[model samples]
Target: MAFRKFSFLSLVAGGVAQTGLAPKKFNSLPLGAIRPAGWLSDQLNVQMNGLAGHQHEIHLDVSQVNNTDWTGGSGYYSNLEEAGSYWFNAAVPAGILSNNAVFNNLTLNFLNYVIDHQDSTGWLGPEVGTTKPRYLWGRYPFFFGAIQLVEHDPTLADRVVPALHKFVQVANTMLHNNGEGVDDWAATRWEDFVMALQWLYDFHPNGNEALLIDTMKMLKATGDPWEQVFATANFPTKAVDNTPNPFPVLTWHGVNMAEGLKALPSTFRFTHNQSDLARASEGWDNLFKFHGRPSGIFAADEYLAGLEAHRGTELCLVVETMFSGSFLYQVAGDPKYADRVRSFSSVAHSQPLTPRHMWTRQYLQQQNQIAAKNMTPNPFPNDGPYSNVFGLEPNYRWPKFITNSFVVTPDNKSLVQVYLGPFSTSTTLAGNNAVTVTVDTQYPFSDTVKTTVKAAQAFTYLVRIPSWVVGGTIAVNGAKATAVAPSNGLHAVNIAAGTTSLVLNLPAPITTESRPHGAIAIHRGPLNYAFDIPRTQKILARNAAEPRAVDLEFDSSGTWQFAIDPSTLKFVPRTVSALPSPVFDQAKPPFSMTVTACPISWSVAGDTFAAVPPTSPRCTGANTTLTLWPYGATKLRISEFPVMHA
Candidate 1:
């Protein structure tokens, strides 16, 4: 029965409808050259709430984003700054990708956003017009044309590449025209040149040699100090204070740049100049040396603070790193990069993005991401004010901390990492192999990930058994199977020719925990488990002073629940040591913070205060009790406490 169910999963994931037809030459464009359009295209359906053939609805949203008068400097509720053409970039492609009904319209409209704004003096930013960051904005066309027209339209590339080069030169001259240049001379110039090279190389593989030589000479001339440091890695270019304890080592920015250079592998496979490749290699060496964090992250915060908890790590940096890493994977053609890209995007970014798809926090403290309080109170962020974990911020669309917007080509082969969401992938398998994998299962919470592989051939399918999977049963046709082949996370699978059946049953993750602190952050799979306080804004701070005693119990039916705050959860020493919990190792002492007796409560929203509200408002303070639930399941339970003595 399980085998039958898995068979159906693969059939629905369709790919390469025209495999029998002659194949069109794939456009060999550099990854991260202009930001991938196929990545954007694949996400349209999900981002627009399953935009499958729903082209009109997308056009409407795109239109709104393009309407400067309507949007008018952010939304009315929150006085946040607005992107000049927030709608144009988002809407244009959404319409273009939905189908070609308005392709020309969106294409021209997007071009207006790109070309019209550059000044003769060479300045581009949102401040100039709808388009901001001239060089960054310039690369969008490159990405948009990648899937459909990178190679096919020779005339288009001839015109576009040269024009792009001219615009960048003008933009650079504005910044580095003389000795006095922008404060961020190296970072900006590096990005601009890299992007330009990617565009020229994409259009003309044997691109303008004179132009390339001239650009390299320009870089060698003027000769900024950053170039030598980046190219040579003399001593890792760093700003001290990366660790939570502030042991001076590496900064995140340096790590991001290094990763960017690694992206060159995905961008260019064959290069004539060895010097450029050598320069890129040195940057990568420094990337791992100083900035790599224990959490498998490159320490990058706006503050340049080391990899310490409570020190800020910007959400934007995480997205960019993952995006850049994906480019590196494409460039290096290494499975390790793919594995990191797939896992980090899921564990870090995808998990944080809220299901509601609104309001994302700008920063995350790695050590204590599970603080239940709002931390907005105490008129400071470092301290707790609200009951943490289940809180909301407006303007942050979707809690997805990292947006991994790329399609997994499940044609002939596929790879699964962080098995949590519902996915249907279509890919071309070996020698015109058409395979589609439609995985349908309530997993992570469930041990068995019901997977089905529907393909045109009967070939060996390599299913990655996660490290967490200690033991599992593999059933083929209801008869138990003893062995599976090529079990590593990386491998190109070939299903046997002329057979469309492949089913793999995976085991569940086993975990045990012990709590040493007064509070514990619950977790289920990638989601950090939480106590949901469900009430309007009024349900604030009622449980601010309460400490949850860990008492997680799973029922015989496999429904697990944690019974905490034993009615007497106050200034009490933790007695429940044997409970599933997060690792907060005080013995390591890598993180620094002073514990205090500063107890706080949530406001009832009656008065104007400067503190973050509690996680859940108290349903009642008059001898009323509140029950807690998880954050994702917002329909029931009270997360905050009633603040009453037992």
Candidate 2:
């Protein structure tokens, strides 16, 4: 198949010809277009009831209460980066998706404050004057959040768009002036800045196309050479060491690599270079081949940790990787990228990155983690001793926000790009017909999906068939089911006006993956099964003044040293009246699996972290049926186990 290039204008309504711009395969809908339903709604509520909803009131230092950088105060930049920007980013989607009025109002107030306080010289954040050095890295996230807000609530667009234009003008001037204000962090992850620029150009250029294009070009030139790095031998294939080398900062940094994954693809949009797109794909494959964990994220506590299951993968890296995967799926239209987005959203989010409540988060999560405590000589190369402990702002904090799983097809149809939990969306299709799509299913937990479409006129509804699915079927209104022969991984069904029903069943079977050190990981559908170990939580700080801001440590109370017999694995379905409040809670998993296993001598490194699984270790104790929960449900778990032969 010949590689195709698209124009950004081609996807928009009545878009004008814009030369030298690469086209996107898909474009995301506004914030409230898709709203959470079923267990997905419950997950968002859990976050709102936890830290995300109340961070400003509790985490005084980092939250917007004191960090008035974007609100015109001269607060520290780190505070905005760590908490303020991330809080707004998560809160906006959570608010719009869940329809929480308070969260919506809170986000709107912040937006108004920032927009109202824009500096006269087009500066957006706390770095206001030319007398001191200004860092442009912090403003990128704040603008990302601002862009989302304007997308969802366009009432602010008239104001927000103008503010953004002014800021970009100043940014272009700064970049052209010997790349002033472009620091190492901003230079390494300039793709995010380019993404914001591209969104503006695609949607609201308002006759400023030249300025947006020149700014993107300058940013790309100032940024790291991600295309060459990924395309050539410069990419790191091994665990990065602390000792300095000739490698650029993007090669070893985990978050940068995750964010940088979109650099070449975003660059391809403007450059229209197929090699740039191809190299982006190459970089993604290489990153996971050398550093991927069973939980669907690459290892990089701070740097590129290798494939050792014991190495910690940062929570920030997981979120950024998901975002990058989403971008890749949208621009490249690859089923593999969508498949990864689904896997990472289901498995990595369920892992011990954060508790069910979403109150506290880990700096680094380990696949072989058995204890969540402060460690002496921590296993993470670039993290502190307390990296694994869950706290309000463990090392640095960034809340996990929901990414758009649906895309607006160029033909004005809505496409389910990534299959997630139950959700519904209302949008206009071709012929100016209004349509509402309601997907009802416990997906990633169950293989069956039931979609109900209510439309004023007939239209085609598209859903992606994951790469793992084979011989899937789609039935319309209980009629004879047809085999789903996907073209480019999408199964499209024609629907009549008024109301229509769709039942899609993608068979999910138990599968095993061979891991590092001769260990094995189990998967059924999108969920990865792990050995759930019992643990006792200890509050690291019991400050009466700040009860909710205290840190927590978890110690394993049950035996975690086990090698599984994969042949004995059996899927066990549990009947529940309703899924629990915290969907990822260990006590209320909707379903689980039972497998015969025996105790083994899996030693510990650093006196706390579990060592690498022994290669084909012999079971020392009698075989027993052990219940395995979803990877996300367990706080202390062994996801990758040594294979014990029967």
Candidate 3:
């Protein structure tokens, strides 16, 4: 497979000159260039064998692409956003990254069908004909799937590119004429649509440059004022008011907020206004400052809830936030955004939002969850009683599409953006020299990361030293290289031709983060530590309509109200020859920590959720050594615990 090479100007400009900004700091490699290996590979395989692999069989109504309305069929049971388009968006990346033949074929078939059945009027999907009520939001995800497909298999470009251009022309007319297809959802999420357009303009313009740019301008004129909202005092400083109102209030919607993170930065590519880029940073800081949790995500059960231990965050929000962070890192070249991506991917992935088998997942996960049962007066303002229950379709299905890769710098050198689990990449460097870099490490679980680079010619490699690392060191070919302090959190190393071995040893020191009500969360490296409370799972009766799907409820069987002494934290490693296949399993954690804690007088909130940790709570029992495991390993946990002083 040959990868197309574009000039740096074309990579940043989208084939048009910008007014204010220069080229992007880093550019992403084409899809399928990076492959997951080692423990990360095991994780993807587990996902493929579980709910992701068989979602179509289990949830026929939503996942069955052939019978859905997007494919010009009669079945329109689910919303346009969640129908076949959603499944394709989630499955395409999974299939391409894991090289799964079944998933690849499924995506390819859907893409071909949609392209073949496209309406002569240039309207895509089922919302065809002028009389029909058209909503443009669903097409965004559908096109996202199409973009990934064409990137991996460029043969589809001849067909896919033309079809996309035709639709964009229609969209441009619609936006110009009384905002025909723009709804509250579409208006708030124009960022995604803009992203698809930018991709086309940058890679496959095909003489549609003017139309794409015009459509983006019209969308911005009519879309939500995310730039102003982030820059001004209108940004919500607390939980949004969720009263019943006639008008749609999208400011509080969890998923919208996650998508809005990149709205300004994305717009800046076109506007090239420095202020637009600055506001993007402001919005991210404000969101996390008001609603952030110890798990490295903000509170948004259905809306933006305030910083309370028991407030829940939706799984969809978590994944979307990760996506936004990844994009921001590439476009802005900020290390903080890379840190945000690593924290959410590592810590949030460890949370008990999904089961060990990845079969069923919760819509929302609480920071101090003691039970996973239905609540009578549902804690979430907009969600139902079963929002926290583990089920096939708890609320919605959100697929994980984020990947780890080496980013191409403006100077065409390779930059290791984020240090995730084992992964490898093959790409061409400057002068068309082929290179393959493989990273071998049990990272986040272990402090040492060994990278092997095989290149046909000499090139420079830049590694991001995380903001958390203070005494990190790098050795080249078994000898210590002269320490150069990182600039913007990146350390550069010059690599020679042939095979070069690099070892990076980052100190994994125990750290603590202060939480609301004087509680604290422990962290080592990227993994957050939590008290793994004993729990018993009861398999709820299967839904007769969906026999293959299973709903589960977990109840704590042991004490969860314990306050920890952070000073007594001791890292304990399990003596294993190799990391377990399913490394995140609660019963088989790769490592643990022994911490001194005591039973505290913590109470329940309305007997439905754990109450906020008491400020300086009185210890009720003698100190006992408690085992703390990775946050993702625990079914029931106290991630943010009140501090107990001796």
| TM-scores of all candidate predictions against the true structure | 0.51, 0.92, 0.92
**Can you list the residue pairs that collide in candidate 3?**
350-632, 351-632
lDDT of 3 by residue, 1-646 (tens): 0111223243233455664233667877777878888877877777777667766655656455545344334332234454677777877888887788887877787777667666887877655533567778888888988998887789989989999999898888888787778888888888999889988988888877777776776777767778666654656766774544222478568899899887877777777666666789988988888888777889987888888878888877887888888778778877888886676675445432355566777777887888888875567778887777777762322333235446888767665646555888888977888989899988777777889998898888888887777578889999965454688988888889899998888766788998889999988776778888788888885766556467888888889999888899999876565778677777566778989989989988765678889888778989899998888777678899999954
Cα lDDT over the full model 3 = 0.75
Tens digits of per-residue lDDT, candidate 1, 1-646, equal 0001112111111321211111111222222212212222333333433221222222323323233342232221011012323333233334433444554354444444444444555433333444423333323323333323323234455544545566445534543454222223333233434444554544443545445434333332332233244454253434343334111222234334433443334213323323433455555556544544323344444434433323333444554556455554334333444444433442242222333321222243232232323343222223233312333221111212112222333242343322233344555545665765555433332344445566676655545444434444455534554444433443234544543433454443312222212223332222222233222222221222122111111111211112233322222112232211111111111111111111234332222121222332322322322222222233112221222122
lDDT of 2 at 81: 45
Q: What's the distance in Å from true for residue 530, model 1? A: 5.4
Cα displacement (angstroms), candidate 3, residue 502, comes to: 0.7
Task: Tell me the whole-model lDDT of each prediction, alpha carbons only.
Answer: 0.34, 0.76, 0.75
**Model 1 collision count:** 66
1 or 2, greater by TM-score: 2
lDDT of candidate 2? Answer: 0.76
The residue-level lDDT of candidate 3 at 217 comes to 68
